[model samples]
Target: MFYFLKQRFSHLAIPEKNAKRIGMFRTLCAIFGGLCVAYLGMTLLLFILPVSPGESLVIPLLFNTLAWALASLWIVLAPTRLRALWRSVLPTLCFAVLIVFFFFKESM
Candidate 1:
């Protein structure tokens, strides 16, 4: 069955056992990373740059959308998909930690 698939749809086929196993993992990670990039990109921009409230809210929204698109593109184009996943995952984790830390700190 899969052999027929490989023959007919080589581009979509799982090239190897490892890639087959990791495909789902990579896909999920890419999705999560894209979301994280959008959120983190916006937060980082607001945290680091001086964007006043008087300005249109669309600025950050546009950046957030662009960030997600770039992250998704990077994941798809990367030579080593696992490495790409980790690269985004690390930053996502870092942003999550920072967000949590600040949330707690403010409450204290």
Candidate 2:
């Protein structure tokens, strides 16, 4: 099974180990993590910066989209498999923490 998939995705430019098993999982993590980080970062910026409503809404959204793209690129280009996972996962954890904090704050 591994050998079959290894050769299958070689042409698609996916690494063997990645394509053989965990490629989809890695891709999902990177994509979703990037989105999560973007939202979290946007929220933080909105709270910290004293911008007008326009700037607050537009700038953060732009930055968030850019961050997502950059993060996805980083994951694909990382040299090691674990590095790719961690790069995505670490940001996700950050987002999770921020979300928890926001929820906790709201409950108070």
Candidate 3:
């Protein structure tokens, strides 16, 4: 099943390098990291701002969708840069999660 999907979307597959498994891991990390960053940013913003549940849900949904699109494009077009961006963004996301976890404990 996974192989079929990979064959169908072969353009998005990482190039055959010295370590194909490592390349695939890096690609997955970038896509997931981008999603995590977007979600964390929006989740924190939701807690800090005055927003209805419906509005809050929509905001994060849109951000995650956008991130997914960008991540897919990065995987197809610029795999190398994606790894660097993931590294830079992941820390910010972790910090955001910590802030939300600590400060918004009561509100959530």
> Judged by lDDT, which candidate is best?
2
Off by over 4 Å in 2: 1-22, 52-55, 98-108
lDDT for each residue of candidate 3 in 2-83, tens digit (9 for 90 to 100) = 9887774564344445533446545666666656665666666666567675777777667777866665555434445444
- TM-score-best of 1 and 2: 2
Per-candidate alpha-carbon RMSD to the true structure: 8.8, 7.3, 9.4
TM-score of each: 0.58, 0.60, 0.48
Candidate 3 wrongly placed segments (more than 4 Å): 1-22, 71-89, 92-95, 98-102, 105-108
Name the lDDT value of residue 69 in candidate 2: 86
Displacement of residue 51 (Cα, Å) in model 2 is 2.6
Evaluation by lDDT, superior candidate among 1 and 3: 1
Candidate rank order under lDDT: 2, 1, 3
lDDT of 2 at 100: 75
Which has the better TM-score: candidate 2, or candidate 3?
A: 2
Clashes of each: 0, 0, 0
